[model samples]
Target: FFGDYPREMREMLSSNLPKFTSEEKRLLQNKADFIGVNHYTAIYAKDCISSPCDIKTYEGNAMVQAVGERDGVAIGRPTAFHGYYDVPEGMELIVRYVNQRYKNTPVYITENG
Candidate 1:
């Protein structure tokens, strides 16, 4: 994940994403002992590439349009934060996803709301 950008990110951002030199790539190999995950909630992601969107959202850089609702239904219980939602299951999903991606790297839930 360090030598080159992930395929999805590359596809979305292309040249906007940075490239690493040989020295940087060597330093990144087997470097991390763990991964810190800060998961709050999961939002529905619409492909902005296929649909109209402002393309100025937090996820716009990923070519994804994120929304808290679908078919006028909220994804989960609302939280104090405007966009953050109360979705406990999301935490497990996120941790599991990270574990799979990092492959044996210890994952810590550094923050949750």
Candidate 2:
């Protein structure tokens, strides 16, 4: 649950979090009946807020540095595309997360192999 601020998010991105206007917040409430999730693979997450990361990326906004491997072991089966892995379990986890976060909203797997 989120209030004016999310505890976990605020712990990493304090002032970086955007302030939403009342109109925007109102518009966002129950805006979608279904949620579409585009999942590729799972990875190891590092707290870039506490440590250093080489490349700044979209995930960096959440202060998470994602890597495909840990301790020389890959997170999942490597795919032909770089950074994309074949991790079927990730799909289940992501969908479950969406269901919980979106109050069991109908979910569509928008993108997958």
Candidate 3:
């Protein structure tokens, strides 16, 4: 992984994201041997910055809304948990995302259900 946060994230968060010092950047770069991921479900994300949304969700600070459904259709079969869903494709998508983002670091599925 790179030393600092992703460029797009920094741009989106602006001053909200902390600045990394030269030493910090050096220390943080490529620090992880492998990436551990816990994937359960995936849902739609709605940009809240340019649109009106109920910002009460956990991702409120990120200026995005986590949506379980779009156009009144559920993203996948619902689980007993309120927000979580049974989306098979989410696992593959998440793994690919981590691989691409972290430069193909060895990944372990630390926790999944």
For candidate 3, write residues 1-113 as lDDT tens digits: 47888778888776777888999999998889899999888899988888888777453356788899998999999999999899998999999888888885799999887
Candidates 2 and 3, the one with greater TM-score = 3
Off by over 4 Å in 3: 57-60
TM-score-based ranking: 3, 1, 2
Clashes of 3: 0
Candidate 2 — what's its lDDT? 0.79
Model 3 — TM-score against the truth?
A: 0.86
Q: What is the lDDT of residue 46 in candidate 1?
A: 78
For candidate 2, lDDT tens digit of each residue in 1-113? 23346678777677788877877667666767788888877888877767887766764575677899987989899999999788889999988888888795789999987
Model 1, 13-111: lDDT tens digits are 886777878988778776787888877787988778888766675534657778998889998998888987888899898888888877867888798
Residue 46 shift from truth in candidate 2, angstroms: 1.3
Q: Candidate 1: misplaced stretches above 4 Å?
A: 57-62
- Using lDDT as the measure, which candidate wins? 3
| Range of the 10 consecutive residues with the lowest summed lDDT in candidate 2 | 1-10
Better of 1 and 3 by lDDT: 3
